[model samples]
Target: MAAEETGLRVQEALDRLTGTGAREAGEDLVRELMAFYGEGLAALVGAVAPEALVPALDRPAAAGLLVLHDLHPEDVGTRIVRALDSLPRTPPVLVGHDPDSGTLTLRRAESGGGCGCGGDDEREVENAIACHAPEVTAIVWEQAPALLQIGSRPPTAAEAR
Candidate 1:
């Protein structure tokens, strides 16, 4: 589905979950469906965001999903969780892969949690980490062996759209 359409669906799901004049879908049901859609959207955005940078940088590998590296292990995990949890009712999914171990870990955003409600305040730290980290990789959405030595740039209008 298109990003706008998917966003609408998420809003509808939120409305239903909150009983805000939406058809009486159960909260649990809405949450489940919203979670699914949000995760998919997150993956799509993750994949596309980096592509917009490739043309500007003249690097093929730069056109992939952004990943945080060189962070303290605990910091990496916390930031991942925090990023996921900051989404609205339809929170995004975070999938992290460790290439050396060939391990992939999946995490869901925590509903109604601390990080989910703070908006820009919470994002400040995340933005900082993304800014200061030079060892990060931009992995292709679903492919592993993350591209090394590539950096993340701010999302462009096309990518944000």
Candidate 2:
């Protein structure tokens, strides 16, 4: 099974167990741990000049970690541009963004030729967005690129009805 699928299953099981007064307690523990680690991360980040933090946040894993700790210094849009630029090939065109809803849409370039990316591309893109642009709650495809146009050339005006 995919790692994502396994993680989702574990989350579901955890949610089930939380129904018996365990949710609040579990949340308290997680909050305490997060507070502890987040403070340390914030201190380390704060020690460095703001400009110096870019290099550290540019790394995907590091970015995710800092974002989780709420220590990332960049805003969502900048992080998104950084994430999109990280993709191997030509990045898609961002069509629209709804800040209120955290919905972003992008259009695949036709030159991509129906990439072999499968579904992993979506998850990877989403994960990247979450790390840098957590405010973007969802990614939507504005258009799927076409490999070819089916219609032949249009006939001259004489054929018009």
lDDT of 2 at 105: 90
The 10 consecutive residues of candidate 2 with the worst lDDT sum are 1-10
For 19-120, candidate 1 gives per-residue lDDT tens digits of: 564555555446556566556645655566544533432221221122321212233455444444434444334466464553434333445546444456
Error of 2 at 7 (Å): 28
Q: Please provide, for model 2 over 1-161, each residue's C-alpha lDDT reduced to its tens digit, 9 standing for 90 to 100.
A: 34465455556656755578577656655655566667767888889888887777778778887878777777777778888788776676777778999999987644626654447677767776776778888888876654576887798898875
For model 1, give the 10-residue run with minimal summed lDDT: 63-72
Clashes per candidate (backbone, < 3 Å): 0, 0
State how far residue 153 of model 2 sits from its true place (Å): 8.5
Q: How far is each candidate from the true structure, as Cα RMSD in Å?
A: 22.0, 10.4
Q: List the residue pairs that clash in candidate 1.
A: none
The superposed Cα distance between candidate 2 and the true structure at residue 152, in angstroms, equals: 13
TM-score of each: 0.21, 0.68
